[model samples]
Target chain A: DAGITQSPRHKVTETGTPVTLRCHQTENHRYMYWYRQDPGHGLRLIHYSYGVKDTDKGEVSDGYSVSRSKTEDFLLTLESATSSQTSVYFCAIRPDRRNTEAFFGQGTRLTVV
Target chain B: AQSVAQPEDQVNVAEGNPLTVKCTYSVSGNPYLFWYVQYPNRGLQFLLKYITGDNLVKGSYGFEAEFNKSQTSFHLKKPSALVSDSALYFCAVRDIGIPGGYQKVTFGIGTKLQVIP
Candidate 1:
């Protein structure tokens, strides 16, 4: 209930198709991140944005891309989805403080066939 | 690199019994630790955090975590386990002094706690 919402809560698509997940936050937090959660991998950061148009790669950034054109919206896109990319995606936001807690969205469950 | 580890994959406890979900962390400098819980198909919800000060940090839903620097651990504890407490728990850490203005929280694989009736 952090005013964070992830769209397309469930998605299923074929491999080689494009997929996009959207995260919207009303808190106006300075940092936003996209993460994927697998059975044994926990939650791995794929990409993050500190500000509008300022993006950076995370530990598992390969085959994933992110964009933040405004403070409230962050988008994660997979140019060509793969079966390996099938996982539950979460979006998180943190205020501009060193030890501030991060808030998470409900999560998007994506499956690639 | 900053990291967190939850040693147990699952923990089982009967209602009214004391319960613990262990977590340990590694970081070069002082680390900010946190605990979060996730219900099935839901997002991770903040439980507690250890930023500084006291070693015993109390969090939401009758849960607390003790930060033991020497032991490199922040184990979560609850005096009594409730059936509702059954959920997946995650521990996370971040270096307090990491530069470049990005604070990435590294999470543990998560431990599933089942409180039986």
Candidate 2:
């Protein structure tokens, strides 16, 4: 798991409710990413953080937001949850070595009703 | 835009037989390719990567991928398939030259490899 943890492994929420997923890493890696896994879509990045406070949107950033108050924690928030947002969310840390594969955390399955 | 493509939705191979999972990429600049395997209900595990130097990069679990610049491919191969090798495989590509901001790492739709025993 590379010291990465995603909280609330499984959750079911009502539509239009606010939900936030947490990604905690002890690897001290500089790069942290938020991704969602869905059918027909391998893993789409929602957002990523380069440093403690530096963050950027990914390809599928719409309807979602991320915040990184500290280096070890990266949070993904869905302001208004929808059925379309139901999927498995994964958090990953880019390896320190250049051009290497990133380490992933156990996914959090979120179901919107 | 940089992207990765896994043409096949699934690949099936018999135990002890050779197996190949195809992957191709389209990138603006020099491509940094990678392969990751995901077991059922588990996180993705890094299998191998092709940055530069050698065309054939060997990785964990006796898996290897060949980088073909002309074909724009980095296909994952294994000499002998094991039942344990049955899992979902994903190919990803990212540009090395991007500095700061969103270093977009695009992933393919993933191929499910089923090794029958």
Candidate 3:
């Protein structure tokens, strides 16, 4: 459970339109990540934040942006939606300790028409 | 760069039979490996992890994984399969070898396990 929640569990937006997905966590973990899940490709990391206002790009960060202005929220933004951007997005958080595993939110399904 | 590979796309086993899902990893230094299972339309659930210590790590739901440093592998296994065990399994890795701080985790493409009745 890990006290994580992903808002807009399901969404559909027009191509070339702006979209944003939100991830909120109550555990107060220092690390949060955004990933997209696609068939065969598995989960691809889009971006991550190690601390409030500190962020970094991931393997599939192109065409996507993220902001973590506060410790509890990490936002993923699609500058201009594309059909290729349609997928199930997951948000994860892990403790600062090195030995522990990350906890995941339910997930957000976004479709770009 | 750290990476994980799940060589199988799918595996099937009859109920009560032993099952295994393979995973291998590449890291510049030491590694911290993990296994996760996902049911349809659900988020990933942690099964087990290989941090430090024993090579054979056990976790939730009758799952265990063997970590072999020489082969660069961490394969998940269960003694007996249950129909309820059918799901998508993911193997993930984090490179502790990376200096400075903890690195990001990389997950495998996933292996679908079908436990037939």
Candidate that would win on lDDT: 1
Off by over 4 Å in 3: none
Local distance difference test values of all predictions, in order: 0.94, 0.93, 0.94
Alpha-carbon RMSD to native, per candidate: 0.8, 1.2, 1.1
- For residues B1-117, could you state the per-residue lDDT of candidate 3 as single tens digits? 788999999999999999999999999989999999999888999999999999999999999999999999999999999999999999999888776654778899999999999
lDDT of 1 by residue, B11-52 (tens): 999999999999999999999999999999999999999999
TM-score of each: 0.98, 0.97, 0.96
Which candidate leads the pack in DockQ? 1
Order of candidates by lDDT, top first? 1, 3, 2
Candidate 3 clashes: the total is 0
Pairs with steric clashes in candidate 1: none
List ranges where model 2 is wrong by over 4 Å.
none
| TM-score (chain A only) for the predictions, listed in order | 0.98, 0.97, 0.97
Q: List the residue pairs that clash in candidate 3.
A: none
Summarize candidate 2's per-residue lDDT along A1-113 as a digit string, tens digits: 99999998999999999999999999789999999999898999999888888888888899999999998999999999999999999999986636768999999999999
